[model samples]
Target: MNKPLLELKNISIKYDDKLVVKDISITIQEGEILGIVGESGSGKSTLIKSIIGLLGEGGHIVDGKIIYEGKDITNLNKKELMVIRGQSIGMIFQDCQSSFCPIRTIGNQLYDSMKAHMKVTKKEALERGEEILRELNIKDPKKFLNSYPFELSGGMNQRAGIMMAMASNPKIILADEPTSALDVTVQAKVINELMNLRKKFGTTIIIVSHNMGVISLMSDNALVMKDGECVEYNLTKKIFNSPSRQYTKELINAMPKLKKEII
Candidate 1:
């Protein structure tokens, strides 16, 4: 964990004439968990999107570089990017279910994904996927794997998404508001599973969320953002206990009473 796995140096993103993320720089070290927190529209999601080159249309990284594994990926061709995403870096979105095909069963997608990235037959992929889901505490992996996306509850689908993200054993995982849709109990379970991934695979993780409480439990370092710029970036304890910015202090104050441990 001594070396930086990914570095965002003075990165700026814009959609048409409107600037979203401005001069944002952060370093994620090996086997470290980083939390990016901010209110809605604070450029949290946009920042991550810029990382994986998934900014869709009209969004561009106008300045700065994104260094990954000592290589600058700030601007790469389509083939170069395909070689990095999924194989080396994995991403789990806020609405996990939305990423799945409504017409496909869980196993179908899992098998195809595995076959694409690994040297495995469909049968082998299905079995491996079932085992991964079971390890994640998904109930009756066989049955759930056979079910369509809508057949399972939101929490189950979210967990399945997490399972899929880790199935490839990527070195880095980027979670964008992974637990926002789940209840408190389910949220804890998801966070626990993510921590387990770090311990088991030494996966470097970057979690983005609006909840400071979630950040407290999941990240060692916190990055507080507002209006597309970093308000504070430091160790979690410092951000919580002695925030340098008034906005960060207000964020700690706004956290629920039950989550006093965050501050």
Candidate 2:
């Protein structure tokens, strides 16, 4: 088998001296989608953030190594880490609005992102931006390139954010509940788009979500978290049909549907 693209070995995180994520380890190979599923406040988000070096103030990585492309990135300096953050590892947070610039045009944002990592002229950046927007199935890229964040709908903004992330052709993408804020119909579309991203680019993805349906649809493997620890990790099919942990079973049962059956 090919080597893993990203690996977290016995990773742990702590906030203000309190342990949050404990000894969690996972490996993601090229083009594979790994789902980290659990309820809110389950520390799955913390795990993802730690990998991307996005943990908030007062939080620290307490243990383990984050290896990417055969290098230990756990202790990389700020300058070295910046090279990897967006160019090698892209991230999509829960709220797209939070990531956008309120005062900047969408095109400027994408252009700036490209310029930051490479020596590209404005015209080249704009062309790359349009290409990504088209890949996301957005119509009228020229109009969108000129529009501000406030001018677009939530779904449009989400796709724009995705375009920004994909602009770099990063090796790994961390999607933290990328569609939780959208309506059910829109959510399905966004999820499908995320899967399509991998299909097109062969980018490894780690999606942290609470929706079992989303996980089952997008993930090759799923890991279930509770409190501060990972209680279950298995192939997505096995995790759905025959979870090893009772907590995971309960979580699967907790999803309400119109076609209900006895638990």
Candidate 3:
């Protein structure tokens, strides 16, 4: 059997000396999508952030190890983690627009990021960026690439963020509620784009979302979290169809289903 692409072994996290994420563990195989779902403050985002060393101020891992491709990265320094982030594990935030600098053109920021991991000219980077944007079904990719982040709509920005994350051609993508901020129509589009991304690049994704519908649509495996603990983890179909935990059942029941009426 092959080893997991990424593994979290009994990981726990804290913020300002207060425990926020309890002991949790998960393994992600290459080219697979793993979804983490829970209500707000369930530490879903915190757990994801811990993987790439983005726990922010006062938040630190207190226990266990994070192994990626068989390497222990739990205590890697900022300099060491910088090499892993983006180049090895990309991230898509809820509001991707905020990731870009307001003053820079989207092309400029993308070129800089690309240059960080690989030696690529401005023209080459722009061309590659355009290619990814086009793959995401963004119309007139060149125009969007040349424009500033503020000029694009929220949906466009989110798509561009996904492109930026993919620019490095990372082995894994950690999407932290990538669609939560968008409307239903846009959310569906983003979800489809993500699936398309996986199909095209064979990239491994670990998505954190509170929406069970999104989880059901995107994940091969699902992990149900609550109050910073894993309530249930299983195949997506099994989790939805035969949830063992009451909390998991409630989450599934909460999803909005279309009703048919007979006259």
Candidate 4:
């Protein structure tokens, strides 16, 4: 068996004096996609944030450890953590706008992020950036790169954010609600691209979503959370076919089932 790529051991998180995420643990294997699903405010977002040290103001991990690539990162200083954040571990925010600078050109944003971690010149950065955007099928990289984030559509911004996260070629990506803001067709494109990213980079992904269908489609294993506690964690098929918790069952039942057409 292969060693786990990332591990959370009995972790708990709190915002100020209020404990939100209860004691929980998770392990992600190399090149595997792990889906975390639950209703809003179920601690899905906060859990992923904690992994990358982005729990925000007044929030902190109250218990356990976050081990990545065989190192305990729970208490690393900001400087050390920064090295790991985007280079070793990338994060996709639930709100794509929050991930980018509104006033800057999207090209500058990607270039700056890449240079922050890589020793690449401006020309090299631009080339690499164009390659990634084109790989994701973003049309007119030259024009789009020169435009500010506000000039692009929601789906484009979302995919651009993904480009920034992938800029560093990180080993693991923690994505929170990556598809929540797009239309059905755009959502499918984003979903397919995320899966393709793993195949293209061998990146280990942990995606947080409220959509059970998305989870079943994207992940090999699924973890269900409710009110900050673990509901069930198992293979995606098992979780879909025979979930161990009522919450998981309700989530599955809520999805719009596809009906077969009569001949």
TM-score for candidate 4, residues paired by index = 0.94
Q: What are the models' TM-scores?
A: 0.94, 0.95, 0.96, 0.94
The candidate 3 region of ten consecutive residues with least summed lDDT is 254-263
Q: Per-residue lDDT for 141-165 in model 3, tens only?
A: 8899889999998999899899999
- lDDT for position 249 in model 1: 81
Better of 3 and 4 by TM-score: 3
Backbone-clash count (model 4): 0
Q: In order, what lDDT does every prediction score?
A: 0.87, 0.86, 0.89, 0.85
What is the Cα-based TM-score of model 2?
Answer: 0.95
lDDT of 4 by residue, 1-263 (tens): 78888999999999999888998899989999999999888899889988878888998999999998888999888878788975899888777876799999988988888877768887777777787787788878888889899999999999888888888889998898887887777777888888898998898999998777788888999989989998898999899888788888888888745101100
> Clashes in model 4: which pairs?
none
The residue pairs that clash in candidate 1, if any, are none
- List the candidate numbers ranked by lDDT, top first: 3, 1, 2, 4
Model 3 spans with C-alpha error above 4 angstroms: 258-263
Candidate 3 lDDT (Cα, 0 to 1) = 0.89
Q: Candidate 1 — which residues are off by over 4 angstroms? A: 258-263
Displacement of residue 186 (Cα, Å) in model 2 is 0.6
Write one digit per residue (lDDT tens) for candidate 1, span 73-180: 989887777767768888999998999999999989988776676677878877877877876887688898899999988889888888788777788999999988
Candidate 3: residue 56 Cα off by (Å) = 1.6
Tens digits of lDDT, candidate 2, 1-263? 88988889999899999999999999888899999999888898889988867887988999999999888999877777778876899888788877889999999988888888767888887888888777778889989989999999898888888888888789888999898888777888888888888888898899988888888888999999998898998899998888888899888888745112111
